[model samples]
Target: MVKFGVLVLLSAIAIGQGETTIESQCQVCQEENNVYCESESTFLRMRGAMKLGPLSCEADEVCSNSGNLCKKKTEITNEVLNVCGANCQSCSADRKYTCVSRNQAALCLNGQASSTIIIDCGEDEVCVDDDDGKAFLCVPSCVADYQKLSVPCSSAAFTTPTPAPPTTPSGDNQKSICQAAAVNKKTLYFFTYADSSCRTYVYCERSSSTSTDFTTTLSGSCSSPNPYFNTVSGKCQASVPDNCESEAPST
Candidate 1:
């Protein structure tokens, strides 16, 4: 199962020396033994590190052997080179997120679990863990940012040490998941907003390609999006329950 964090969004830092952790704060780390040292190559990792968006690194910033990736420097025993896909960042300083060649929900269960690799997705996409915690996959996000999502749906986005939706299409302009179809193929996307209302939206395509517009499947305000879509009930639920055992996996 995925070890989801409880903190909101990417602010998953462990309190130390009476202050929260900040990756760019290298000077503070030098003064406090308890604090992790920020990576020396901050300039090199700027773009990638920002993607950490609201997520925190496993340790303070210790540079990866390649100097391109960063992770906590304390994980000496678990350090190993891992290959990440183009969708996600090449590596993370923390182990919470990982990259897999295949879009399997499975986390880094094998030898690579310790590496700081993040699953790949589009610039607007995010890595979403399943309700069962057995699988993690990349998908477009609903909340403008991770820090705002609510329960269950927040599990994947809020992967801090202690931190922590869907719908279909229709003929009505509002009922459709998107205004157009996917450029690659017909793919259905799910999202939950971080707004206090916690509205739910979906972007389903009739083909395998990408699309510019997405449709709102459900607009449950003040409610989080269910981790999995219930094909049986055709509604959003905490869990999909079936996991599509009787049917083939949907694209």
Candidate 2:
């Protein structure tokens, strides 16, 4: 039986005429933290392809843009090497790759053919829709269910006086940087959006109408120390932070 990667590569080459002719072998590509499939011929056609860097795939996986993963004809190249551990399945399926065996960390997957990139949300974080909704992203458990997160700190996290709970205070008391409810008192410390500098952690609480009080803060422009918000954990983190939380919604 013909391997999936081999088949995709052959197909691309067979059609190359005016094109630079993709080699008759699978090729790898990279972007951000992702690995994908791209023909050498196609890469050369790109305007700024050189900025993308070298192409590669796992030793066991073949780079096939059509297959979406390192698998061919329904067979996976590297099963045990799945991202997010054995609890998950393929990480190169499509826009959102990954199979969950447990409620543990969800992986943000993206790639073409067999080469893919998997970003870990860790056990505490859950994968959700990115801003673009084109792909999945890891977000804090708190952010996922903000209506149920209880922030009971008696500090200045609340400035805008508004109505109390919708009906009754939710049964959420988990500790996280993303607060769902308004703190009773007013303080000066709050979870800010993750920024490139990771320097600010203070955001003025946005107040809602008197009937329902919800404190919403904008992204970026937070205080220092844990300025950048880790998107996955919905928590404030230090500079050079990972996990996708940030003032830049692009993350």
Compute each candidate's TM-score over C-alphas: 0.19, 0.16
User: What lDDT is reached at residue 235 by model 2?
Assistant: 45
User: Could you give candidate 2's per-residue lDDT for residues 118-216 as a string of tens digits?
Assistant: 233445445332222233334455644452321111111111111111221111211122353224434332333333344322232334323123243
lDDT tens readout by residue for model 1, 112-188: 34323334345554453323333344544553233322111211221211111123222363233244223333445
Q: Candidate 2: where are CA atoms >4 Å away?
A: 1-8, 12-171, 174-235, 239-251
10 residues in a row with least lDDT, candidate 2: 1-10
Cand. 2 TM to true fold? 0.16
Best by lDDT: 1
